[model samples]
Target: MEEQEIYLLITRYLQKETTTEENEILADWITDSVDNEQTFEEIKLTWQHTEQIKLEESTIALARLKNRINHQQDNKAKTKKLVPFKWNAVAASVAIIGLFLVGLFYLLKPNDSVPTTYSVLKTRAGEIKTITLIDGTKVSVGPKSVLRYPSVFNNSERNVSLDGEAYFEVSKNPHKPFKVNTGDLTVNVLGTHFNVNASRNQILTTVSLLEGKVEVNLNSDKDDAYVLKPGQELTFNRANQRVFQRNLDSLNTLGWMTRTLNLSNDKLSDAAVKIENMYGVKLIFADQPTADTRIYAQFNGDSIEDVLTIICASGNLEYKKQGNKIYLNAK
Candidate 1:
């Protein structure tokens, strides 16, 4: 690559705008030689110093400076001794020019710090993991879930991305709100206890608020947002792009936390959905009537067989387990 292009690539890397392939290219260039590593460090410092300036201005300036240096080095390549000499003058020139521009450009503007390091919290099948974030917020990740969060939150807001199920008890901070990104949906909260289920296999992405308030934004649009209160649950249908809000027993949503299958006036179908997710088993209903049966029960860490027995006994239903599938029929 040309010297000008390499400087541009380094700028893109500093701004976190490089693709995976671009990152690989940068990594290779950095490890190619000691001079290349030193050049990278100098450019990094120059980039940091010129953070307040428009990116285009810094990029153009760096590209011009690099091209000049490269031309000077090529001209001196005929002299063996001169070629071995360090280019301290060139490095000093770049730094001085970068500092001058930093003073000239947006001096009073506050710098927005970007998160450079992130940690991913994942759980295997039948596994649950709990973690406290740097902000003192607690998160319980459910089975087969992935939660990607910054090691340290920025000054603006606390943000995390979730791929599956998780329960969040966010720490209260009036200035910085907590945001969870699930596909096209974003959940914003100041401080709240909420359970989010966005499993890939499930047709519905559900958010149940146990305490405090949260705003659910579809496609990151504020106008298409819904504010949910405690005891309210918001369900978004992925197929039709439709959303629904209903009041529900929010405590039932935290059953995974306590290892209990707690249902309060939940339909058989609803219970079946939870059971299927918890046990990694498929629940099939013989008829619609049997699936519509409502039940109110709590099983404290009971076995699947015992829970199924109690559930079937509560209504005129019989259940049979075949492999990983459980079939329910009206008795």
Candidate 2:
């Protein structure tokens, strides 16, 4: 079993609720030899440290974070920024606090059991699932995406890993920050609405901020940070973790997690890929040259087959679905 699985089993054993097989495995594991006992001791020690961290400041920190935000709100109410782009310090601060809220719950456990977990939520091609995280962050995972998060976030930070794409509506807390770690770079936010695209095959990872604010920081040197405002998107090149900032259509970017695909002047190929992913099918473009043609339409509640049929007919393209694979050719 993986380290995380074994850790989970150990945690269950500590609760005295392990199953027969689990108990046997735990016994075999804990008493396999001197080394096994030593390892268990180490994990148990780590679990205890995690608990201590959680208890050390979860309540006080949460309250303080909330107060900071309220104080900021009071300031905003008194003096609204005349120029939106000049200084977004308040927005940045709030987003950070929002992230703090996500991190706070992770540190404290309602059940008081600090479980060791590295389990991930994943979907097949053409599948989508909405997840309510331990910290109450709402994540809409897209097709072929995976999310690896701790069973409970421990004190200090709220972090999760991404392998594909998802949209996050993070809960806010100022004392703790919410961070999403892709293989290449880390996306940190105070309490922001954002979309992350981190497919492994991608040459770069993308984060589009919808509302509030976010900070893009390199995992290597977190102190060096890049703050992002609403309507701004950050893309990090995988090879070097280079962060690039650009403008984006916030609504269009946030649409994915909501199962709403909005394409205005979208290329045929681009639209095809999204449809295929949403429905878990293949879309092969015949007459490859015609595939680059752009079409403008909003596909929120459309079936893949019907969407492809309509788009193809409009473009004078023909398509056939064989199992999950689709072959498209121009007439």
Candidate 3:
């Protein structure tokens, strides 16, 4: 392609005018020589500026056209476009370039003009997940739990919201306090590891600290804070917005966060309810009083049968299953 034709191609590109073949020819010539590249840039930039000027001119033309149409309608005998508009229409070819640059910069800018970003990670019954947060905190969410945070954190603060249970290996950035919003309670830490259990209508949203100090607020909106030391657990009462710190075995409390399950001789009915809710399944008692039967066990990625088989053998309980549902009856 001649260098002269390349100049003509410049106008066409600004108006989005070139066919594929023409554009390829233009691209080839521009990339072929250093002089051609500079010449192409100058031409393109000129076209952009000229295109903006033409756009403004066209907008004015359009406004004038509309006014003339209205005038003709108001005076029926007055003809619209009595003098045909002598628009060369090449103004847009001159004006749109600068606008394109401004728009490009706006899209590529830092923070990208988006104020806040939020994410929710939830697991249902029998399902679990491992997730990483914006602040570089790594989490392992238990079945029937959810963890949420922004896709990106701002320089001012780092925040997350959660429902259910999760083990957090929080990333350390002293200036930005990592905060977790779990319904009525808020867990804050400078840089630490912890586990939290918060769910809807639950009496207590328990928080177990593994490392570092975590400020647990029963009423997140209130000034009151309960600072939990390593190896201490705080049960934030969702009902009354009270925090209770207890001396507990960190291993047992943090058990569910791992691949194991630990239940300290909890009631059979309570355990059943927990299992059903965690897995989103139904546990029907074939015998009404049987559900209240007492049981004790630890689960570590055990199959439903492994847990049931032991429970049945130990408690003299009989069980039956049909489809995804299970029934328990007294033996």
lDDT of 3 by residue, 1-331 (tens): 4423455566566556666566556655644544455445544433334433444554544455446546654664633223322234323434333323222222223464434546788888767788755334678887788887775565556788888888888766666688888877888887888988888747778888888899977555668778888888988666675667887686566655443545665567777756665545667886657877777667776767787787776567888877768888887
Over 4 Å off, model 3:
1-104, 107-112, 240-242, 277-280
lDDT of each: 0.74, 0.68, 0.65
How far residue 129's Cα lies from its native spot in candidate 1, in Å, is 1.2
**TM-scores for the candidates:** 0.56, 0.61, 0.63
Model 2 Cα lDDT, one tens digit per residue, 26-132? 64555344444545654443444544444445446556544644665557654432122212342344432232223344433355555566768999877788876
Candidate 1 lDDT, 177-225, residue by residue in tens: 8999998689999888999999877788999998999999997455787
Residue pairs with backbone overlap in model 1: none
lDDT ranking, best first = 1, 2, 3
* Candidate 2 wrongly placed segments (more than 4 Å): 1-115, 219-224, 239-243
Angstrom error at residue 128, model 1: 1.9
Report the candidate with higher lDDT, 1 versus 2.
1
Candidate 1: give its CA RMSD in angstroms. Answer: 14.5
